[model samples]
Structures are given as structure tokens and as C-alpha cells.
Target: MTTLDGQTALVTGAGRGLGRGIALALAAAGARVVLVSRTGAEIESAAQEIRSHGGEAVAVPCDVLDLARFEAVLDGVGPVDVLVNNAGTNAPMPFVAVSPDTFDTIFDLNVRSTYFLTQAVVARMIAAGTGGSVITVSSQMGQVGAADRSVYCAAKHAVEGMTKALAVELGPHGIRVNTIAPGYVETPLTAPYFADQEFRADTLRRIPLGRLGLVAEVAAAAVFLADPAAAFVTGSSLVIDGGYTAQ
Candidate 1:
């Protein structure tokens, strides 16, 4: 049985969408969850929902892009048995149109924040002598490229590489590191893009599943990765792209 009873999980960007879904999943499995997001209200609402469902959760509002504040956030939470680095952003622009500012913004959140957060959390995990699970929420774009998504792709690709390297470094301490590379998921942030006729059509045509993924679907995958059943699974990507990249 895959159980997370008595575990503690910290999910970044848990205000809504995929992060909220992942937090709910982990809490449902009996883990005490800490929900982190830049918006205080959003994260508080998420925490309330979990508590209403008989789960343990705390809402912490902090901009993850500010590395110092983020490190402090982790310090307040103490040792985490599971760390879900789900906070990230994307700016789709033509390769030629992408400016240094655009590249820096995406990479700062998607790659830099994730890297440092993992480092801080893992240090506590090692000191506590408790092997933990680190799940980085990446995207199918990491594995393949797309039009007007150059910077996003670059950031995700960097994450894929970082995961592999971290896994090898942490494996000796029994800490596992991996990423969940999902396809186009219907979220508030992505709804606008999917609403466009041309964008929706092109996206659906590429996915063999012929539809967008649900936040719950991605959440379930994270649970699987965080559970003990996946003890031997490290440095791997659970691709949930509905065959979008299969071609």
C-alpha cells in the first residue's frame, strides 16, 4: 500500500492550480502539508480547504523568487519529509524576440528557486537521518521544444538536468530526487492560451489523448513518486504528456 501517514510535505506555489492539487493529494494520503505561495489569501484558502477535509496544512505566503525569504520560509517549517518544488513560471516568446529579461525571469523562478529550495530542504533531511522525496514539477516542454516557448523550454531542460545530478548526489543519503513532466494542463495560468482557437486546435492535435490534462492527474503522479512504493525510483521523470512528445 502506498501511504504517507505521519509524513510532512512542503509544496511551493500551492495557492491554486497544479500546486493546490498536489498539496491536496499529499494531505489526503495523511501527510502534514505546508502550502507556500506569494499570495496570502490564495494559500490560506487552500489550507482551509485541506483542513476542512480533515487534513493538516499551513499557509505560508512568500515570493519564492526571493531566495533569502524562501530559505527563511523553509527554516520556519523545519525538516520536511517531502519537498514539492512546484513553483514556476513561463513566458512564451519567439526565440528572436526573447530578451535577456525574459530569459532571466523564467530561469530565476523555474530553475534557480527550485535548486536552492531543494538544497536547503535536503540539508535538513540529511541531518535528521530521514531519507526524503523531492519532486520537481517540470513540463513536457523540458523534453521537447515548441514555437514561442524557447525560454520556457530552456528553463525546464535545465531542471531535468539538475534533477539527475541531485539524485546522484543525494542517493547515498537515501534521499530521492525526480521530476514530473506534465503536458498542457488546464490551469488558471494556462486557460487563456487554451481558449484561443488556433492554440487549442494545435495542442489537441499533437496530444494522442486528444485533450488537456487535469490538475488531479498530475497530483496523483506526484503522490506516486513521493510514496515508498517508488523507493527505487530516482533521477527519473514521470512524463504525463498524453503522448504529446511520443512522436
Candidate 2:
């Protein structure tokens, strides 16, 4: 009698971090999860752990930056009830030092890859007549700007805009599209920044909660948005920023 019983969820970037957390959460809720990532060992280990816990899961390793291969991987995995587009990367550089290569690299993975992957998933959802949830892992930077995060902010901002637009266009079909904008979360990607005393203090000071967000916290938000209880919710964002955006 779990909320997601019998549903299938596909979570990209599922090898580790928030993606892995979300995948585990969905499976715990009774969904069969397709764990996708660029690294085979990482996704496989994650999928095995889910299986050991009595939840159904499979690993599909493919770099999402390659849209064609990503689409092919999705085709093989079949239709999904939920899609978490969480594959993203950030290169923090001052605006003056930001080059075209830096911008494209970040946007290609964060925005472009997410955009096309969601498109493919929604198309399958439409064809099957079984509407699904599309959740993109955005960031607090998407809502409020930060120093040396110009490209990251730009990319996440694009994701937010697309989510809202997609929700508007797909709501009539029973589809839900939303983004989860989380503050500094303790993940492999952000670990280095946290290791710096000055940076860590600066980040924590901005959060009213006085702590970094955990991957599980963000995952829980994904579960809420994916559940049938959120059927009426769309074209919105759930910010898990620990009150950072309040100020």
C-alpha cells in the first residue's frame, strides 16, 4: 500500500548524491527504479543495494550529455512513471573569467541534457496515456544569485523556466513538471567547497537553519512531488534552501 506502488521511476545521475538518495526513496515507496548515470560501477552498486533491500531497481549507465545515446538507453528501459533529471555539473568561475567553453559545458549537462531527456520521457508518457511526474534537481542559485556562480545560476534558471513552461503545456494531459531548488547540500560535488573554512562559514551563515541540507531532505521533496497527492501541483518549485532565500 505504498504511494508509488507499481509505478516505475527513472532517475538520472543516480550513481550518487541526491540522485541516489531520490532513487532509493522512490524504491522504498514501492516503485521499480531505473538508476542511470555515466559510471557503470556506481550505478550498478547503487542498484544492487536497492535490490538487497528488497526494492526493484536496474542500472543504466550512459552519459546524458549525449542525447542520442541517452534516448537509446531510455528506449531500452521502457516507459517510466517518474523522471528525475538530476545529472548536472558546475564550474565556479568569476564572471570576467567565464569562457564560452565553461558556459557550454555546464549548460550542456545541466540544462540541455535535462531538457532533451525530459522531452523523451514525456513523449513516452503521452503515448502511453499514463501521465507522469518530471522533477528537475535545480539549486538555490536558480532563485538567488551568488558570486562565482554565474554559469551555474544561469543554467539552473533555465531549468526552472523550462519546468514551468512544460507544466503549463502538459497539465491538460495530467502530467506534472516541477523543480526542486535545494541550498548547499552535502554531496561529492559540493564537498570541496565545504572543506574550506571560510566558504563553509559563509554558506552556513546564509542559511537560517544554520546547516547544510542533506541528500535525503531533497529526496523527500521528490517523493512528495511524485506522489498522487500532488496531482494538482504543477508549474512550481519546492525550495529546500534552509531559509537561505528568505533573506
Candidate 3:
């Protein structure tokens, strides 16, 4: 495992769930972390938790949807050696019932935010000649479609495509871009859905491993992709879905 010692990593949506887990993992691996989220106090608490473990971390309250501000992200974050685009949301709805607002909301956060945020960070990386790793948090839905999740699936698929294209374009600069697509990760936002036994049982049946994924598991993958040891990896989707997509 390549240590990220002396590296500075910026992770969006670091207030909770997979984002928070990834931030902590990167910090544990010796990277100074910048925790970004729309909520200030939440990420601040998370940052303090990292500091409690003697890891360097800073809470940066930010909305990645603000592309304009991302142009100046370096101004607030200084130099980011690793960029994790993890801020996203999903709303499951029947395809026919998906409204324009629902579509826009999902796409704006999942697709547009991911595209421009990476653009800003990679641009800065290029100018400084400091190549970095960009790990986008995608979903198994990106690879296969699901009922009532049409909009969400589309957004993730768009991210999957964008990541590949960006990886190719940024490879010349030594910047690596890839995505981590996890399936059925148990998080706060998903705990409610799993409360319904039918949904839970069906989801479990599809996963060969017989359980939902853990945030720590996904976080571990993010660390691997961010490490310098993965220098040769790019335009790839590392799926941590317990063989859900294998079928």
C-alpha cells in the first residue's frame, strides 16, 4: 500500500456516511484532509474527530453545485493532491412520475457538480504540475438500470461516462480519474428503505455476499485509488457490490 504521507486530500460530502468514512481513511493513511459539505457545523465536527485521532483535517463547508466557487477552490483549500467527488443525492421514482425538477435535482448534484468540481481541481493540478487522483462516488445503478430509479441511474451513468472521458483527457497530465461504484451500502439515507422487509430480503437475495456493503468497505476502495501505487489505474470503475452486478 502506498502511503499518502504529506499529501493533501479534499473530499466532498464529508459530513457523513461514505464521504466521512473516506475522509477518515485518507487521514489515517497520513494525508491532510479537507472535509467539504453544504453544512458547516457537521463537517466541522467530523474534522475534529479526525484531529482527535491526531490526523490533520480541516472542515470546509462547501456546496459542490457551486461551479463558480470551484474555480477558486484552491483559494480556500490551498493545494489538493487528491480530489474525491462524493457529494450526490438520489431519489427513486417511477419513470413516468419523474418530473423535470426531480430530473434536474438529481443531475445537477450527481452529474454537473461532479463534472465541474473535477474540472476545477484538475485545472489547478495541471497549472501547478501536481497530478492527483479523482475518485467519484458512483453506484451499481450506473452499470445496470433499476425500477423507480431511472433518474438516479441516468445521473450515475452520466458520471461513469464523464469519468472515463476525463481520465483519458487528463492522463497526459499524469492525473488519474476513476469511479468507485458500490451497491446497497447501508447508510442513514438508506436505513429507512431497508426497514421494509420485502425490500431488504430482495436486495439481499440479489447480492451473492448476502449482505449490504459497509461504508468502511467503500472508503477503503477510495483510499486504494487515491494512493500513488495505483498510478497506472485510470478510467476504471472499481465495483464493491458483493457480486450484485456479476449476474
Candidate 4:
């Protein structure tokens, strides 16, 4: 593992699933990890898990949508060297059935809050004069749309656009901005969806690898982006989709 011994990493939505996996990987790699989630007990458990393995970690509970409270809590975390904008929510519905509230709920957390949170973190990185990496956990849907997922596609696509713009703007400051787009990863959030045999078979058929992605697989991508070895990589999308998007 490329060591991040003295660096600090903050991962949002880190209570479980991909966020938890990424937080664990970063901690194992030696970065002091700050795990943020709306659920206090969950993140606290994750933090304790890291500490059990001799890694440094901190758990912070806050709703990312609450900007004022988030910012206030962030102030106490000190300098962050790597930021993973991983907190997001997706509620599937047909395009015509999408109410205004549904759209707002999806876009607010997936796009709006993520955009502003990154802005805040990037600003602090600039002020501190320390170069860093900003990684957003996007989705293959961001590059291609699917039925009943138009809103999610829109939000992820917006994230892709924002990342590129930020990369160009922050390149001079040595801040790298990129995204990790995963396709149908098997997490607690998605396990229920797989209960339908047809859906599971159809999903696997689309992926050339013919299998669901592992949390560790996606977490490793986050580690790669944060490592010094990836210093030259920015404004890029690392798609861990088992070739799903390739088709």
C-alpha cells in the first residue's frame, strides 16, 4: 500500500457500504481517516474498527445537506489531505412519475450538497497551501442513462461535469479532482435489488465480467487515486463496472 502516514482523509457517508469500505482502505494505507455519517453509532463502530487495527480514525455524525452544521463540524477536523465525496442517495422512479420533491431529494444530496462540500474543502486546501485529491463516487449511469433513473443520471452527469471544471481550475493549486464510477456494486444498499432473479441475471449479463462488483474493488480505486503514484491522474473517471459501460 502506498503510505499516507501523515495525511488526513475525510470520507462522507462512511457509516457503511462503499463509504465504509473506502474509509477502511484509507486507514489501512496509513492516512488518519475521518468518517462522517448521519448515524453516529455506525461511524463510531467503523472508527473503532480502524483503531483496533492500529490505524487512526475519527467519527463525525452530521447531515451533509445541513451546510451550516456540516461546515461547523468540518472546522474542527483540521487540515484534510484527501476528500471522498461519497455520500449520495438514489430513489428509483419512472421519468413521468418523478415529482418535484423526488427530483429535489435526489439532486440535493447527490449533486447540490456534494458540489458545495467540495467547494468548501477545496477552499480550505487552497488556504492551507497543501495539494490534495478530491474523489467523488459517481456511477456508470452518469455516463449513460437507464429507464427509471433519469434523475440519478442527471445528478451523476452533473458531478462528472463539475469534476472536470474543478480539475482545470484547481490544477494550478495542485489539487486533483476525479471520480469513481461503479456499476452495480453489491452493497447492503443494493442487496435487496438483487433479490429479483431477473434483475440480477440481467445485470450480470450486461457486465462482461458476469458478476457483481465487490466493495474492496471500488475501495482500491479510491486508494489508487489518493496515492502519490496517481499524481498525474486528474479530471478522469475510473469506472469499476466490469465493463458494463463499455457495452
- The candidate with the higher lDDT, 1 or 3, is 1
Model 3 residue 129 CA deviation (Å) reads 0.8
lDDT per residue for candidate 2 within 1-247, as digits (tens), equals: 4799989999999999999999999998899999999899999999999999999999988988888887888789888999999999999889999999999999999999998999889998999998999999999899988899999999999999999999999998889999999998999988988999998999889889999999999999999999998988999999999999989
Per-prediction RMSD in angstroms? 1.1, 0.9, 1.1, 0.7
lDDT of 2: 0.92
Ranking by lDDT: 4, 1, 2, 3
Candidate 4, which ten residues in sequence have the lowest lDDT sum?
1-10
Candidate 1 TM-score over all chains jointly: 0.98
* Candidate 2 clash pair list: none
How far off is residue 207 in model 4, in Å? 0.7
Write the number of the candidate with greater lDDT, choosing between 1 and 2. Answer: 1
122 in model 1: Cα distance from truth in Å?
A: 0.7
Clashes of each: 0, 0, 0, 0
**Alpha-carbon shift of residue 14 in model 2 (angstroms):** 0.6
* Predictions in order: lDDT: 0.93, 0.92, 0.91, 0.95
Give the Cα error of residue 132 in candidate 1, in Å: 0.3
